[model samples]
Target: MDLAPFKHVLLLPRVRPLALLMFFARMPPAATGVILTLHVAVTLDKGYGAAGLVGAAGTIGMGLGAPLMGKLIDERGLRAMLAVSVTASATFWLSAPLMGYWVLLVCSFLVGLLGVPMMSIGRQVITALVPESRRRVALSVDSISVELSFMGGPALGVFVATKFSTSAALLFIGVSTLVAGLLLYWANPPMIHEDEVVDGPRPKIIEWMRGRIVGVLVVCVGATVCLAGMEVSAIASLEHIGKQSWLGVVFFAMCAASIAGGLVYGGVKKAPSVLVLLVVMAAFEIPVGLGDGSVLWLCLLIIPMNITCAPLIAASGEHISRLAPPTARGLAIGLQGSAFTVGNAIGAPIAGVAIDHGGAPAGFAIVGVIGLLVAGVAWLLARQRKPVATQTTMAS
Candidate 1:
């Protein structure tokens, strides 16, 4: 029997109501970093340290909020959590312009706390609603949309800030978030409520945490750390070369590469295993260390590095979905999101300090080393499987 026919049945339309909702919802948060930085620079009359604090606060909020929101989705329903989060995000965005540095920090933090969970919930919903065979394609589409938003949000934020005013950028992000949230609420996708189903009661959170699911999360955290390190190092290297102007070009190229990767991933017959994907992704880091500081070389290197990112992320998502129990899927995915947020927050500062002291090449080397370490760990995890006897017992 050809597995291709089985996989074809799983492919769903790329543009669905839920995907549209997530794209818009992610825009504000995606754009916020650039706008918030500019706003702090222009309005707060503060130093880089202060701005860094504000940025850190938002990342921390995202890390804290995502898992909580996932738990909420599990306990209540998608609709209720979506409504609450949207209202919270709208309020934060509208009030952002009026706030001082401290207040802005708090507002941005809360906004991140509320904003990021929607993506996790949306992923959970899609996993439940979409057929198993088509899920990889569907998730690849979602991953591409996320990469596009990440690329566009910062650029748009910078443009609006330069053309109009910082406040104008904030206003745009605020309104976009509100609209996105409301649309998700109205569409009201089917909920995957594990609480309602009576099957020997739901597993306790602690119990659920004790298994392969946690192992998967550990690998996810490692991959995210590598990703965050590379992103920070790449930007720092560009700036050090006195080609800060090329930052956008480099980022655009990387994102474009990821988009291509995602598209290709959607059409694949047998997706690579998570371990294999991580190994491939680690290879992307070699270019970061190998490329000379030339903008052209850097840009060229980014293409291969980015080509692996989306597929790795999509594979990670697939692993998480399959391992997590139905009721805990939201929380599990939320935790996975939190891992990435935390990794980025930690990686950026370390890369910045390394660049300041050691030079840009040092930063890239650091990231490359981290990626290699993570890849090794992933390989180890792949090899150390539970015995077949245990699998048989679990199945029984």
Candidate 2:
């Protein structure tokens, strides 16, 4: 695959620095995913259900709060939203080690609610900084960067907690998150200027949430649901096979496959639609159940299973950027973010319950079936989602 597009994207003004920030900024959350599950399961001696609940709490908050903060960014700009949310996130991360179970759960929800809108902001800035011609490649880089972050985040979280202590790991994440927040605040990223909104009628928020844009989000949510299922199931499969140590490698390889797919997608002249990518992703997920008995086998399966991840993410970001009205840019992106959050919020716990009851095979099947069903829904929606402009013009 060609590396030129990635190189061209990085050289853009204002993009390289934010890309750098993305490296550190995405790590802590990635780490938290691994660390929190380990901390609750290994340290606190909780079950997967409990761990899933905690995980879901954070995602639920993410789902609920992303749009609110996104709107804040739209109305007030990036500075205040970044400052307030990052501070809240830092406080919660730092205090997590000391809190009890219920408190930690509540805190998880609140932290996610208050979590910095980094993904939304980064995409918005990328939309603002790059021209339309380069937007897809830029978002492809963004998605690949996200995969790279997950490569380190969870493994580091698990490693630190294992070598030192969960408390130490939490402290590290807390400090690192604090620094990231500060740096982002200092960076003061740009927002959508929405110059056209100055003279036009204000479009209602629901208008943005329906039709083609929302169809993109449906694909996003479904894809993420598959991802969360794979994650939890992988964790269960590794533990089942007594090769739990290889968990990090499996996640890395899968993410690496996603990166590879994204790079290829970026370089291509013609790409598939988001719904088509989602269908491909769901199709790959079905065989995951067959690999449940062995970690090595599971890793082999994930190469195909993850081939669509980054490409889907890149496409969704591009469409959201292309679709939303200027004034509602933040909210639109925020809604997309929330869809993934909602997927994650529900995905793990459902998979965990499946794993708890019927083991890894069951979890895999559940994810695959749901993914296929959801992809079908997204595809049907996409077909029907003609832009209202064309229909309205035709009608008039």
Candidate 3:
């Protein structure tokens, strides 16, 4: 396997530290919801439904706030945005243990609304730091880091909550959030590439937000929809087979597949377009439904499907960086975050309903179809635009 791509990205100054910072930075946010849900259900005695409401509120707020925060980063700058978000996040998690359920709900929304823009910033900085030719590998590494953070963060949160207390878990998140924020503030990686001119007249939203860009965003949503739906279906399938205890094992396998995929994607000289990767991912997920009623079968089936996961994510980031102008790149990446939020929000419900009606197989099949449908929409949007040489280049 060619290690050239990884070496090139790591050789660049600032990329290595930024990657490490982002991995730590992502952990607190990753664990927040699960910790909060466990807190509400176990500690507060509110039950799972109420706990879900709190999680939903936080998710909604994050979805609504992502673009606004991105726009702020565009208008103001990174430090200014980080200052406010860090303070809000710190205050919420620290005080959350004291608040009643209702107050906690409101505070959670506020925190999410002003949450730290870690993910978007990482993408922006990575694009700025790496040349376009090396961006695929850079972002692939970043995507793999994200997979690792999500994997460990929640498990750590659960460990603390179970071994100690939910309040301790909340406090842990608070301290980590503060540390991540301050470290980022001190580092202050360049938000815009030096070569890009920000002083020039900015393009109107209409100019850059339509056609291929919209298609990329659609593919982003479809990608997450497949992921979230597969997760729900996998859990349900495990429960159906009384193998629910294998949840961690299955998820670990899935994450491993994604990491392996990302490593290969980064090493390769060329790759399929965002839409093509999304279609391929969705296509693979459908067959996973056929493995229903067996945990081992489901785990094996999801591996090939998940191999496209990180590649799709990295490809989307590469395209967005190429397509959007420097002036609005933050907002474009933020919209990508929002698209992910939208996909996760709806995907679970779609899968849950399908599972309720038709079992785990239907859950997987239905979400896979939803992904394909959205990919088709993306293809149509891209096709509507007159073919451009730049579009072809950006897709790679």
**Among all candidates shown, the one with the greatest TM-score:** 3
Per-residue lDDT of candidate 1, residues 1-396 (tens digit): 133532443344433656766766776678887788888977677876788788888888889999988888878877778777878877887888899888887777887787647557656766766665456776777788788878877888889989999898988987887777677777767655333343566667665554455555555666666677677777777776788888888888888998888777777776676555655665666557556478888878768767867876777776676656667778888998887776677666666776778766666666656656765665555445432212211111
Candidate closest to the true structure, highest lDDT: 3
The TM-score obtained by model 2 is 0.90
Candidate 1 CA-lDDT value: 0.70
Error of 3 at 370 (Å): 0.8
Off by over 4 Å in 3: 386-396
Segments of candidate 2 deviating more than 4 angstroms: 41-49, 193-201, 352-359, 385-396
In angstroms, give how far residue 21 of model 2 lies from its true place.
0.8
- Across 1-396, the per-residue lDDT of candidate 3 in tens digits comes to 577879878989989988999998998888998999999998999999999999999988898888888888888888888988999999888888898999998888888789897788888889989887788899999999989998999999999999999999999999999999999999988888887667867676677787788888899999999999999999999999899899999999999999999999998776778888888899999989878888788889999889999888899998888778788888899999999999999999999999999999999999999999999999888876632213443343
A best-first ranking of the candidates according to their lDDT comes to 3, 2, 1
TM-score of every prediction relative to native: 0.89, 0.90, 0.97
Candidates in descending TM-score order: 3, 2, 1
Q: Over all chains combined, what TM-score does candidate 3 have?
A: 0.97
